[model samples]
Target: MSDPAPRIVRRETHSPRSTAAVIVALCLAVVIAWVATEGVLSLLGLPALLLSPRGMLTSVAGAPDASAASVIAVAVAAGLVGVVLLAIALLPGRRARRPLHAEHAIVVADDTMLASALARTAARTAAVSADAVSVSLGRRTATVRIVPVSGTRVDRDAVRGAVTEEFTRAAPTRPARVSVLVSPAGKVGS
Candidate 1:
């Protein structure tokens, strides 16, 4: 008898943060539209409750000059805004792990989930409690730290091998180098 085909799962690429950006952009667009409409109405001598660009400039011209404190405050606010925009532009937007490229479609899993699986594998292999294992996943590395039970010695090499084997089986898109560190202190409750 022939074996059946493997099932394929789709990966989601949407970022939750992108929704906040879209809503902010829509709000800004609405405010810009209102300002433009008001400006046009003022130009045509229609009744416009909102101030137009020209009216705003004329008001500023007739107003008293800004004090030193006010000028410094405005400069500080502008600097803060610039910093925020720069961070938004430079920071990595996606939180999803690298996608596993397949023949038909790509598959992706959360880094935390993959780390948890590797931790479980290591714990089982080391004969230690799951809580004794800690896994940290980086872009190109997976660090597994293990704490053995009190008065019990653990084979670091065996735990490392098991962790690396589990990571390989998981098959993350980008292969990560596995590093295992055995803590000096062990938990009393195992």
Candidate 2:
């Protein structure tokens, strides 16, 4: 029998670059639209919305002579904005997601779903209700919070072992460190 071809998946994470770019484009468009409107109004001998294009150009041309400090400040602020936009475009954005190891298929798991599964497994192993267990899955850590039922003893080791085993079996590309937290007080009727 021939082996199945492995599936190729592009592990692309969500990024804020597109949103930022759109915001920037919209802002620029608004500014351009305002300028064009003002210019047309001024040419047509109509009252300016805020300032006529001729007056705006004159003020901009004379801005440097108004105050050297203000000019420098504006230049610095513009430069900082440019740098920030550049960094946003160049830096990689990450999400709370990881790829699971599979033989011939690609599988990505969200952190929330992964946490739920781990919590369910831990809860089942501890013989407690699902609500008794809470899991917080982070980029490099998975914290399990367990609240035992009243008058029932919960073994932290067993819960930890079960969660660890489940996590290992799932085999995420980036494995998270597991930490179990057992509440000192047990909940009643849980």
Candidate 3:
């Protein structure tokens, strides 16, 4: 009987939302520390001039009489902060590339690594210099652009097949559709 295939384990990673949560927590901590310090100092009969809670509230209460320009500036600053926070809350964090299932352990490759590998494979298959190839790896697609030698014609299908083969060997968890584009303008001296 054939041996059973080993299980593949994926690597654990933190999401961007977690990082943002940590940042928010730290900011809250700072605010809490300031308020606590101010309250303690006030109780000790040595209230901070402008940092105390009462002082801060009074400052806000008095802001209505501030110059128009200053008010506008403050409003703009607050708006910017709100926009940033909203973005952090709404934006999707970067997801690590899906892991490839293997016989033993799961394998993962960065998008850049996949692009480089595809580019190199395409270049070799097309018999062109590596610099003449450009590759873009997306979540569901891999695009390879190749510039053939000035006097030679490159077979697009051949390049595509080569890149696809290489991609299969890499064995990404999610298979990407391969696309090969041969540039109209060929490179000279390469």
- Count the clashes in each prediction: 0, 0, 0
Quick one: best lDDT, which candidate? 2
What is candidate 3's CA lDDT for residue 189?
Answer: 81
The pairs that clash in candidate 1 are none
TM-score of 1: 0.65
In terms of lDDT, model 1 sits at: 0.76
Q: Any idea how many clashes model 1 has?
A: 0
**Model 3 residue 22 CA deviation in Å:** 2.2
* Each model's lDDT: 0.76, 0.83, 0.77
Candidate with better TM-score, 2 vs 3: 2
Query: Model 2 over residues 10-129: C-alpha lDDT tens digits?
Result: 334344477898999999999999999998998899999999988998999999688888888999999999999988888767777666778767677777888899999999998999
Tell me the tens digit of each residue's lDDT in model 1 across 1-190: 5432222232243244566578768988999898889888988888876777787888678545767787788789989977876677666556656454456555677888888899999899889999999999887788999999888888878888888877776674457788888888888875
Which of 1 and 2 is the better model by TM-score?
Answer: 2
lDDT of 3 by residue, 1-190 (tens): 6433222222231135777778888999988888888888888989595587788888899899989999999999989988998988886554555455466654655668768878989888888889999998776788998888788898889888888888877764457788888888877787
- Model 3 TM-score on a 0 to 1 scale: 0.71
> Which residue pairs collide, candidate 2?
none
Candidate 1: residue 59 Cα off by (Å):
6.3
| Superposition-based RMSD of candidate 1 using all C-alpha atoms, in angstroms | 6.2
